[model samples]
Target: MPTTHLTPTTVITGFLGSGKTTLLNALLRHPALEDTAVLVNEFGDVGIDHLLVDELDDEAIVLLNAGCLCCTIRNDLVGALSDLRTRRARGEIPPFRRVVIETTGLADPAPILHTLLSHEALTDDFRVDGIVTTVDGLHGERQLDQNIESVKQAAVADRIVLTKTDLAGDTTTLRERLRAINTTASVLEAVSGDIEPAKLLDTGLFNLHDKPPEVTEWLRAVDQDGWSPDNGHHHRHDDGIASFYLEASQPLAIHRFVTWIERLLETEGERVLRLKGVLDVEGSDAPIVVHGVQHVFHPLTQLSRWPDESRRSQIVLIGRELDEHAVRSSFDAAVVG
Candidate 1:
């Protein structure tokens, strides 16, 4: 199945008191997120509560709450999504183009990603847009140093939204720390929860209207050339989690590439918080993009055409205590094969 046209889902996660709700509340009021569906652990979570919820459908779900679809997540997220789909088909709720799930403050986030990307029933209709993490400028540094979950949340994000900059002076050190945790992620500040929704969305490869996936933007950090096997500079966070990348100028044999990915995931999948890249498979005319969260990798997405003239295979990997040389050597073996 093609990735295009699937309702992109964004997971918003952060530590307690990190302003996930504050940012979400401001985003809910924004017109850009008006057509979006928001899922939270409980309605009691007041992330979007500031908005006026107009209508309520029976069965304890808030439909189009805050001028958008808002629902409380039960024990299983799958059931909630299924119910929403059913209601949409029955015209019970307004049609939505995207979805945002707000995770609890202490979440690891890998399990949620696996569910969204690999769940059999949900994959056909929903695709993961990206993970947006909120970090409190005042407490982000302390959280990262003291809490492993907070570090993980920041480590795997596609975008890190730093809140309370207005109150916290000189977040430069905090920003640097975040970049150290995940160099590939875009670090943005949401002072008083003011941010452009566009900066946070569209972080995934797929797009709406069945359009071509934005392969380039999905891996834009590759353009920065951040990682190297010999930089002698390592960015290490809690549990030795770090960001790195491997690239090949020439096309790689599909079999070898697949084998490397299998071995890598089989051994280091849990450590691999996120892995995404564009591969120039030897026998293919267009590039194939691969995205994975932990052990679950999405189906290979071969684009209609390359996003740009750059045909090099670029892979960005975020994991715990990853050995750069070993990964480079293993990748070289695959490419040389």
Candidate 2:
């Protein structure tokens, strides 16, 4: 039998001390993240958050007492990924179907994404499925205002996990800030790095087993041509952050769609933040789903058919200081011309 599916990789990122390890530990304890290989910044470099992480080998490949396998990056990401693939293929390591990468708090996600999606050796077997960013509910506002990295993390997330909610603080303010920053990304609250692993991973257009897609859940927070900055500010956090949706009821021309995206990335890649859309193409029955993190674009995935009865194209954009009018106008021109 042929290889049925490419392994999906999800990047778990957040500001410093945002409970990424805690979340990873909680996810490991459960069966959901089992058989999932994790590439962390370091192993045994810091104390484990929730469970005891025992070193299983000298190569810095450790195992959680709960059976999750993890390895530390030795300043070579491409080498690590290639080595992991080789080990799994040769039956030396567990055949993990999914991989999770935890980036350092101060790290920008765009470069890592560029390597994963654009690298020649990695693209054939691994595909980036989603990015899960964690925000400190108590200090998220200050972080957003002070740190550009924090803002970028939230801007490009597929799911924004709000951690430290049980601590003493008001999360209402943080939630509003995140919404203004990334209206399309799902914001899930975690009590103590604990969340439903299934809900947090494989959040792209399709699952690993190639089952019917979850289109509604993927686009839940976004509305059709809804919530513009010009329509009057509903939240205080909307100062420079904007969230909006664009939809085309009819199928769009393929060339126009590609050109529109290319142009957007070329001119305003830094401000583009996170973009995701499932488009109904003119001649193809399948829907083309595209995702981008800033300037880096993930390989487009075409689904077999529409997940639901509706066949309209919907796109959501989250950006910092983004011009809502220009984006909409350009999209209109693309579809019309």
Candidate 3:
């Protein structure tokens, strides 16, 4: 796949008490971030955090009063992005090139990314540069061991920011443990939410040229063979937590593909934690990438170029109590039929 450079939008996601708000507040104060737009989602009955943030420029901050970005209120997110584009066109908001979405502490970022990447109205205007996950340095090790969402956030991020290092008894040990889970992500330290803004932005999906050898090796590991149902490497949180993959070499029959996906949602909606993948469909010039969490699915998106030369369809699934073999078999049956 040839490289296509687009203006990057970064997402900051982590568990509650991960200092996401603190990091945003600090970033907003940076001189380099003068022209950036910040989208904040606060999950609560009454939204008060919007008032806490000091918006330097007029209309620079848009707060989604809705509780979570992954819920039905996600339409509000689409509206907010649309509004941002309108304001930019009318010169109402600052002419910003970067967008930063801060998900609620308990929020899962996969759905939000799906929205940003798959929204028809928004994709033409913005691209996901990368995901920056903030892990509490003090509690990160324990959190990764216990919290399934936290682990997913770490696994999918292009960059991981370790916050509260000043309080963490052993930053070195925590960092090592994070590396074990996700060795490809660049790990940076933050003290009191203070870190260089440039480091957190623009780390795109695939870093082919300048990445370390280890990172390249890790990227290769993303192939279908890397994740097999026979392997005991499945994610285990509750019976409600699972992670698996789906792969297809032949292009999917578009109509059948739609039916298959819809049926999955109808049958196992609640248990579907996160689903993302690149699909090769007949009649499409490029691969269609889809993302969803729980019942909400952003519109399917087509990348200008494949992330790599591997044109085969490959998807990663995160669900709870969902049988990996059954899901894969069902998808295969649909394609064959």
Best by TM-score: 3
Q: Specify the highest-lDDT model's number.
A: 3
Cα RMSDs, all models: 20.8, 20.9, 18.1
User: Using TM-score as the measure, what is the rank order of every candidate, best first?
Assistant: 3, 1, 2
User: Which residue segments of model 3 deviate by more than 4 Å?
Assistant: 1-6, 205-337
The lDDT per prediction is 0.65, 0.64, 0.68
Q: What is the lDDT of residue 86 in candidate 3?
A: 88
Per-residue lDDT for 172-279 in model 2, tens only? 878988887777788998976678988897776322122112333222222232322233212122256455678889899988888888889888877765566677
Question: Candidate 1 lDDT, tens digit per residue, 147-258?
Answer: 7778777877888998878767899999998887777788998975689999999886522223212323323332243422223113222547555667788888877888
Q: How far does residue 84 in candidate 2 sit from its true spot (Å)?
A: 0.0
Number of backbone collisions per candidate, in order?
Answer: 0, 0, 2
- Candidate 1: worst-modelled 10 consecutive residues by lDDT: 65-74
Query: Each candidate's TM vs. the true structure?
Result: 0.54, 0.53, 0.59
Per-residue lDDT of candidate 3, residues 218-249 (tens digit): 33443322332133222222555545657788
Candidate 2: list runs displaced more than 4 Å.
1-4, 42-75, 205-337
lDDT of 3 at 113: 53
* lDDT score, candidate 3, position 65: 64
Q: Order of candidates by lDDT, top first? A: 3, 1, 2
